[model samples]
Target: LFLGLIILIAVWKLSQTFTIMNLGKETSESLGISYSLLEKLALFLVALTTSVTMITVGALPFLGVIVPNLVRKRYGDNLSQTKLMVALVGANLVLACDILSRVLIRPYELSVSLLLGIIGSLVFILLLWRGGQKDAV
Candidate 1:
């Protein structure tokens, strides 16, 4: 199961890297890569990862939406850079939240997963709201 999880994560990260590099089906196809194949591969990888995460960590609810976007916002769309930044930020966020939860609760640490879900969701909502409300002109 651990090996499966690792494979799924690798595939998921690679798929995301490819997608970031290519941007869209038309662009990817023009560049001679099979977008359909890549899309299917990505979906499969994501599904596997999600299933493992759900079963192992319970409902995550927001890491998927939150961490990657946080990275993209900070680093823009460079694939390698985005992946590196996301991994770093995600790790830092998890570590910080875990510490906060431990210290605040005192011998009753909230699950890191739960903290991430709440924090990520709230942050994502605020970002979306701000983006939507910003003037387009």
Candidate 2:
């Protein structure tokens, strides 16, 4: 519920803010966007999104950082599209990891978080090693 609202804000109210910020601090500020306020709002929205998600669905390690990078890597930095894509991709990635967890141990099933932690860590390391990211995580 709250996550959905924040997602909507990210997709709607804050999309222009993100686009402006993407232009870098000086340019965004010159354009009359209050960087600090928007930054605080973005951070608060992210915190609420994270808290709501963690409280409801439990944690999926590194999905926070990983999904956005993957989306941006493919779609560029359109935060509206990237925000929606991140939600969809995160859901799909979790489902895929859940399936893998159920199958990997045959008669046993691993918790999704554990599999996510392992997989997320490896992918993050790989991304860091690849190292051509124009955006800072």
Candidate 3:
């Protein structure tokens, strides 16, 4: 199915792209990877997958930021681990939100975008707060 294909491609490409990106720019360049091209390619792939996902499922903005950061904070900064973490966390978070949407109003369902926006913003704020606290120490 189109959804499965996009999810697979997104995970694979995300891992490869972020691995290269996290390696500082000078290091990536020295290793013969064109930073700009790879960055552009990664962005394109992400955008394509995101658009497809939105079309099929529904829009859930900030899932990307929320999932990746939650995973990394709990599991550490291993790139390979982070990729899998992103996929798993993103899927689970969506599932949870969908369930909440359906159950919270028995006769009607809440739009996923609304729930994700609220939850994602809170999580992002908490993450920022934690980071700021660490820096202030």
Query: What local lDDT does model 2 show for residue 114?
Result: 97
Consecutive 10-residue window with the lowest summed lDDT within model 1: 12-21
| Candidate 2 lowest-lDDT run of ten | 128-137
- Give the winner by lDDT: 2
| Residue range 1-137, candidate 3, lDDT tens digits | 57759666665766765786778789889878888887887777778777787787777878988888788778877677677768878888988988999999889999888998999999988988998977420
Instruction: Give me the runs in candidate 2 sitting further than 4 Å from their true place.
Output: 2-7, 132-137
Q: How many steric clashes does model 1 contain?
A: 0
Ten residues in sequence with the least summed lDDT for candidate 3:
8-17
> Model 3 off-target regions past 4 Å?
1-7, 10-14, 135-137
lDDT, model 3, position 137: 9
Which residue pairs overlap in candidate 2's backbone? none
What is residue 32's positional error in candidate 1, in angstroms?
0.5
* lDDT ranking from best candidate downward: 2, 3, 1
**Using TM-score as the measure, which candidate wins?**
2
A best-first ranking of the candidates according to their TM-score comes to 2, 3, 1
Compute each candidate's TM-score over C-alphas: 0.79, 0.85, 0.82
Query: Alpha carbon lDDT of residue 23, candidate 1?
Result: 77
